[model samples]
Target: MGWLFLKVLLAGMTFSGLLYPLLDLSISGKTRAPKPNIVIILADDMGWGDLGANWAETKDTTNLDKMASEGMRFVDFHAAASTCSPSRASLLTGRLGLRNGVTHNFAVTSVGGLPLNETTLAEVLQQAGYVTAMIGKWHLGHHGSYHPNFRGFDYYFGIPYSHDMGCTDTPGYNYPPCPACPQSDGLWRNPERDCYTDVALPLYENLNIVEQPVNLSGLARKYLEKAVAFIEQASTSGRPFLLYMGLAHMHVPLSVTPPLENPGSQRPYRASLQEMDSLVGQIKDKVDHMAKENTLLWITGDNGPWAQKCELAGSVGPFFGLWQTHQGGSSAKQTTWEGGHRVPALAYWPGRVPANATSTALLRYCSIPTVELLESMGACRLSAWTITRPSTLLGEPKLVMGARVLSNSTLPLSFSTWKTMLQKLRPYREEAPSTRRCCQRSPGFLQMSFKTLLMTTAPERTTLRTLR
Candidate 1:
């Protein structure tokens, strides 16, 4: 009887494994997620090892650990670039910084920023009738044409760039003194620009200067409060909303609540991580209470940890490198190494994405375009059948090969290879199947530009550019 029971249990497991997709599709029945809300909580410079779910030895980041256990975690995830501006540009546009012309962070004095023409994720969702709000850091662009308000978000409450930028001469902050960094104590008016100008860090609320040199202590909590308020406002307004919460903790000059300072971790960075974890938990709890079934939540980091800060920088997980440089051609932060670009990605949607399941499938920040495309195809459904059901060509072998090329091939390691893959797949989305097949069949026929190869810089460590 025991042997028979064991056999029956094995059979049941096998049956469920095979039948799960069919059962799900049958129950869902070609239905789209009506009025589904989207929320993305992005942590700045938070490492994979910082979460208790990913690593056992972390200082009990309970909120993020709970998030991973409740959602689907991607073990092999990556940011589009290693730096703030480029990674963020990739996140919004579904393209690389090289393609988007945002290769580095914008300088304090210079007005450079992400190009205005590139489409952002917020823009796409907003076009699909979703109310959008961006709370926290907006590092992609700070200048006139490239600001968040102009890009897509309906409401923006965040700093123009990294908090570390525009460093002040204030005590306890050891930033390099800059000659042209607007040195002043109180608010000063730039009459020609018609905006408040100051040496201190400026915080903006929809193009207006709200605070300069925002108090570092309890800043993360303030951001969380703003996000919760925005969620409440958007929910009551009778419109689906997209809340992009780009967290500023764990970046630099880390601060934490007094309660979090001693009980869990004596280190400031650890305390900051603890605070961030609780903040995420609060937001997720709000979502669960309001719209668990109708909301899709994603939590991830912009890039790897800042290794230069030693004990204060956090861990890099099992990847590679410590600080800016490591042996074996591996590096962190500013370089193209896996340690630099790879970050955590977790997605949660009750009754949609499989709970507690992990997908090792490689994902890029650039695939956000596919999300936009899926949303544009009508009612959005978060399942495998959504793409396959709408388009008959996804199952074809040639298209599968194209998909495999994008997923499995080493071609995407370089920017040129990524361009080749995109050039081939763009047709698949455009309904030009013949063109896609032609492109896929002769994938190797595409010539690699010598200049592109020459332009590619080998990953190496240099002087630390920014604290972030």
Candidate 2:
């Protein structure tokens, strides 16, 4: 009997030893890490059909398609607003633009700045013990008060608004290229030029101008390099970070890759998209190579795709009933149509979020904060946001119509418009900085040469201090 009891006890011990590791893993899976890095890549005006992963007939984006294959995608993601500034407002404050006092582009210059009353995601993330950085277009505001530096980003780079929004019809020091030239009508041009700060299209680092009216591609590479460095830094320091990469592509004067430019049609757009995909691939490889599979990476466009029509570029897909009282131009390109807001979204955290996990939870650009995204990370609580109301959090849909929440202005508040808005929006928000005060002001030189740095080796980083 003693011998039999001894055998049973030894067997139980063996079994427990084998199960111990598995039990620990199960418990850890439910717990939060000290901190995890977050990467949000925002593509401008890219459409639902534009991605190779989607069923778009003309566009071709292979790397993006591959990402979709490797990760999960939401067919119904949305943008905060159709236009750049409003959308940016929604992204930053997690509230509708109307809530912040913006309704239309009619008096865009005077009204569209991101109000100081509201806190931005950058500020929230920074307060949560994460480093933040913003790269690409910042269409929220231009005044010193509305500038990115004051909004919570520790570092800032990229354009202040739409590439051509500020381009003038007049050709002079402070003016734009001659609109008199017929070539200007339907031509590809950079709105970035020398301004009071530096060149109008200058590269801004924090509050200083790093380069004058610089080319976006060069700046994009610099931004990416800095982001990668930030990742390395974050990993080494054991602090979580939020890296926002705003890509200026598939939008403008139709700047396609040279190969695609030869075709100068949808194909050019395809090429540009593919290039952007390649850049994404580069970032992904870097992160996966450097960190464990637990890091979260999210990629999506800011709004709908734009199509080139006679002289203006607007939405590509058929997005009906998008314009409100003050906004216009075309259907979905900037409208509230599904094509306008139904941009693509992909999230990945190999070990955490289930691979190929298709979440149709009706994600809105402004609702990201309500996703318990920060809480899941053990971050601080956020104050009131228009999107994260009690109803929405309780598995109920927030009625998304009516006037601006903060401004008290009327809007085209209707179910159809709301549906269109929800269907068309993508996963985008104004980027918060990854770290405070990282980008020293720079003096940029874009016109020195126009050759693209793409198809070149990876950027290892060089001194841009002299440019400033």
Best by lDDT: 1
True-structure RMSD, every candidate: 17.4, 16.8
Given candidate 2, what's the lDDT at residue 348? Answer: 57
Q: How far does residue 183 in candidate 2 sit from its true spot (Å)?
A: 17
lDDT of 2 by residue, 1-468 (tens): 999999998789768797677776788757754556778788787776565544434335666666665665554456766666666666665456656565444222554377677776677667768778887787777667888878877778776776554332222211222222223335453445322221244467788877644553344467668778877887777767777777777555444333332453544445556667777888888778777564678787776665433222333432322332124444465654445666677765665544433333343211222222443443221211112211111121111231111122122221112212233233222112221221221211011000010011123311111111
TM-score of every candidate: 0.67, 0.62
Q: Which pairs of residues collide in model 1?
A: 201-213, 307-323
Q: Lowest-lDDT window of 10 residues in candidate 2? A: 445-454
Give lDDT tens digits, candidate 1, residues 1-468.
999999998789768797677766686635644556888888888876676655555755877766776766654566776778777777776556667787777756658677877767677667768899999999876788788898889999988877766432221111121223345455554444312234567778989988766655656777888888988888888688989888987787566665343533466677677788889999999998888877878888887787766666766664443222434343456665556666777777777666665554443211222332333233223342111111111121122322221122232222233334323333322122333312211111111111111121224311111101
Q: Which stretches of candidate 2 lie over 4 Å from their true place?
A: 1-32, 56-59, 105-112, 166-199, 256-266, 308-330, 364-468
* Global local distance difference test of model 2: 0.52
